[model samples]
Target: MGHGGQRDPSEYRKITAEVFYDISRRKNGVRPCPGQGFPTDIKIECSKEIRDYPVGTKVRLDVVETDKEGSRPFLYSSYKWEHEVVE
Candidate 1:
């Protein structure tokens, strides 16, 4: 599971990807967080910028020791805060 929160939309990087499917669980008992609405899972395929990689070649996904370029994505937090006040 991965989640990211950014203050600026431009802080997010844009990449080219081939979308496979987009699934929305709104009608399937999916509950929305206070600020965020319903959730949707989108599947996509993208090519990594591996040096010397041949075009149209398929490679197995595996873990690497280090990432020189910002290819891999990491999620620092998954919690969403909703404030309620009682008077």
Candidate 2:
């Protein structure tokens, strides 16, 4: 079961991505999800909170399940940048 009593809800997983551009006042950038399992480029929306991080910084993104039929993983709101990728 998923949210709101929905059956077979989408599963969420966090992935590490790199900041392609500066996330300052422009509020527009891109974070590419690098890996063999999940290779996709997610657009970056710089909120007031995450405007400090610079380019080449690795951030975590909570991605939804992409294997399900007709599922849209890119539509998920994964803008919570807390932990930095050490490696």
Candidate 3:
């Protein structure tokens, strides 16, 4: 049996940068399930210029699951950053 609950691949999800950071960085070296041991400096692959978005810039991401599985199922098979709209 799998370690964690299995999820449907067709079911996609969106998450904000804040949520990503919250899951990525945790106190006492304790991380949330599924994303345990996730890399801090993740290099996002996108055609859009990454430099356009400065640090601390809030952004949304659309992610999906991959065939890779480690301590937990990887949910970053591919993703695209949503463009931030200026007021």
Best by lDDT: 2
TM-score of each: 0.17, 0.47, 0.34
Please estimate how well model 1 matches the true structure, expressed as its whole-model Cα lDDT.
0.24
State which candidate, 1 or 2, has the greater lDDT. 2
Q: What is the C-alpha lDDT of each candidate?
A: 0.24, 0.47, 0.36
Candidate 1: TM-score?
0.17
When sorted by TM-score, best at the front, the candidate numbers are 2, 3, 1
Among residues 3 or more apart in sequence or in different chains, the pairs in candidate 1 whose N, CA or C atoms overlap within 3 Å are none
Best by TM-score: 2
> How are the candidates ranked when ordered by lDDT, highest leading?
2, 3, 1
lDDT of 1 by residue, 2-84 (tens): 22343444333322221121235221111112222212222222222321233222222211122226554321111232112
lDDT of 2 at 51: 33
Instruction: Give residue 15's error in model 1 in angstroms.
Output: 0.4
Steric clashes per prediction:
0, 0, 0
Tens-digit lDDT string for candidate 2 (1-87):
123323243454556656555445354354556681454554444343443556666666544533237854442323443445533
Stretches > 4 Å off in candidate 2: 1-10, 22-28, 44-48, 65-75, 78-87
